[model samples]
Target: MECPNDHILLSSGLKGEEKSYIFRPRFNYSKCTKCSLCRDNCTENAIVMFKEGYPFLMPTLCSGCKTCQLACPSKAIEEDRKEIGLTYVTPVNNNLTLVTGVLKEGEERSYPLVLNTKRRADIMDFDLEIYDTSAGTGNHVAAALEDSEFALVVTEPTPLGIHDMKMIMHLLEKLNIKGYVILNRADLVNDEHIIPDYEIIGSIPLSDDIVQSYVRGKPVVDAFPESDASVELRRIMERVSELLW
Candidate 1:
């Protein structure tokens, strides 16, 4: 994630002190050589020397200034720019469009891709724009769901799924965005306490037809409208349609 490393300078009154803060760089240990050059050059004394002679950063004390990067002989210090994701826009129908983003294998950052994909959707002329954000409450998901009127968080009934569902719910509250839950694989468990506080838009039971529709390159609602999961999906759509209209 490329954070804007700008320092906020504030006036200090006590003893002519200046208050400033900035986001420091996180070093890539794989690329860094144990030369200790970066540690020696850091004016803030943020970098400490390891027993192996390699330098590690103390993020709190480090300023956003690139003095260490400029002074390093090996050029090991580099800006964090993980451009390993792509935004995809596909027209599902005249009324429905799908804008998706996928991070490349081994890449962890997801916000940029989400932001880019949302920008693509914003450009299109449509009455109701829907955004399906990636899981988690990280800044990436926040970037995707910013300014959204409503959000639907889908989760399974497993332990991990329930844990993550609570996490996203808290995040929705923090962002002041109203959210509803959709419990997938509902037949697998009977744990309603996982999301006791939030409203459940719909619960979709496990069904083979739902999987088959995906394999057939068709939406489950379009292919098997009578299925249990498909019916729940329609109910969700109807609720959303009512809210929008």
Candidate 2:
């Protein structure tokens, strides 16, 4: 996996800091001897020599390890920093906090941002931390869920959803992380669907109130306490509490 580096800075925002950084190679042509040492030593093959006898970097392929800089015999390579993402800590309420990682637009790499976000959250004082990972089985997702005591594998009743859910479950098994399934939008399918070798903790039917809560930028439990989704979610939480505690 390609990774650069990270640094946390105190932002003007409330109760937290922002971290965003990536290192790239900058060539000092005046000092370059065109020996191709930097290109030769690059493990990622990010450097290429022009017909004019100079090296250029493909930023996307570079791992930003500074290997080229260190290997340059003529001291031509220099360090360049770019902000790739932002990590934010927001006060959700008196008892809750939210830490989010956002990658810059057009940035392809997300593993470093995920790592920095997790590091930021790990430093805060808390009794429990609920990590909400993006929908995928990529390395970024693995990094986010690594070291978690257990995971709630949320999935829908659609065919694509079930297929992807199984892939995620396989990943969790390989990571030695225990997992339980939560069937979301369970009313969409009438057939009896069951996940083998994993317990189903809850079944939540699709509800309009849940959609409204999403539109209003609030949690369903807070926005619609009496809604069916909210009730089912509370039961799921109780089950998880019993399993963990």
Candidate 3:
């Protein structure tokens, strides 16, 4: 019943051997007809035959991939909501809105919240839609970036940055989305050949003004209009506008 990511309770006796899993499956009693398909198809055998002949889930063994729900023709399985994250929408300006999804600390599942946030944004008619994805190419990030027209991958000129940048570039190509790179802190180390395949739309050098703008709780463009960083951002905006409009 214990998977690699599971936290198993290493106690003696049958009752004390239960494990606590991050992803737990909830069975719907009213919708289930004791088809036994869920049990038979589950290679993990997480669903066991109950005394009532209905399906009982050993939550510990469940991988939480929702495969059992797909197997059930009646659609009897429902994933229990764990309140893993919260989405917030705030007005940025008359024309722009900011939607932020905050994942609960120590939570593994964040993609649902990302999807919810995107759905909220999609329902509203807007002139432009920007999906600011999180770092790394996890399912959560994919959920946010999926179907996006363009992904602005911001990275520094370093070995680690180049490595992760290449990974996301490949991911974008796999998703059939055009990607652009904004070399952040370009002054740190300039290597134009690092991500040679992806287009470099704009570059922002390391600057005290850029740091100060962030510290002052404002966008660099709004805080330092004539700063080099702000200029690069404006150039990026113009490019985006040309492509989209």
Candidate 4:
């Protein structure tokens, strides 16, 4: 994951004091000896030095582009990759393999980690894989959707849900991936216009069983196989399999 100019290496994640490979200006300034190696080797000339000879970073001018960091022999430049979090693979009770990417608190670049998790999942053999994506239609969501054969976009029945669903639908269309909408709190709003064209794969009511299962770190499908939510989830998975395979 080295950036082209060799200034930055794509970090796997931070471990204890070890930082990720992305360039963090704050850390760079603190560690730099002002040897001007970064300035001399900078391809984009994005680095600006003060009269005191300290480097000033203009991230807007920066393409996230790593050129200056590579030229610096001091190795002062670093990134917050560890802050992004790591991808974990765990085996659940029903032989379901759970691949999860937990973002570090206050970390901004969540999608890259999600992308990494998905890539890891691709290499492992499993009967079924489920991605519980972060809320919102952003880069993280987009990256998660990239390799997914099918997507279950869960939403509530409200103006906000419809608005977000439309955005996600547009994204899915752009990616040429088909998805089904699952109304989580179906009692809140009307279904008349929510997902008129697409199939309503399944619905989960706002119920205590769902909440209790989630609190106990259990999938509703596995926790209560006979429950309505569990039955619907299985049906949705079946439909998704047909669409994908």
Return the top candidate by TM-score: 2
Q: Give the per-residue lDDT of model 1 (tens digit) for 137-182.
A: 8988888777878888898878898889888888888899888888
Residue 93 miss distance in model 4 (angstroms): 5.2
lDDT (tens digit, per residue) of candidate 2 on 1-245: 12221111112234465858878999999999898989999999999997668899998898777989999888888889777888878776578777777788878878888888888889996778888887789888899889999999998878877888899999999899988999999897665654455688999999999888767656788789999999999999999999889
lDDT for position 3 in model 2: 26
Candidate 4's TM-score reads 0.68
Q: Which stretches of candidate 2 lie over 4 Å from their true place?
A: 1-19, 41-44, 73-75
Q: Rate the local accuracy (lDDT) of all candidates.
A: 0.68, 0.81, 0.71, 0.65
User: Quick one: best lDDT, which candidate?
Assistant: 2
TM per model?
0.63, 0.86, 0.73, 0.68
lDDT of 3 at 112: 64
For each predicted model, how many residue pairs clash, with residues at least 3 apart or on different chains? 1, 0, 0, 3
Off by over 4 Å in 3: 1-66, 69-80, 190-195
lDDT of prediction 3:
0.71
By summed lDDT, the worst window of 10 consecutive residues in model 2 runs over: 3-12
Ordering by TM-score: 2, 3, 4, 1
Worst 10 residues of 4 by lDDT: 1-10
**Candidates in order: C-alpha RMSD to true structure:** 13.8, 5.2, 10.9, 8.7
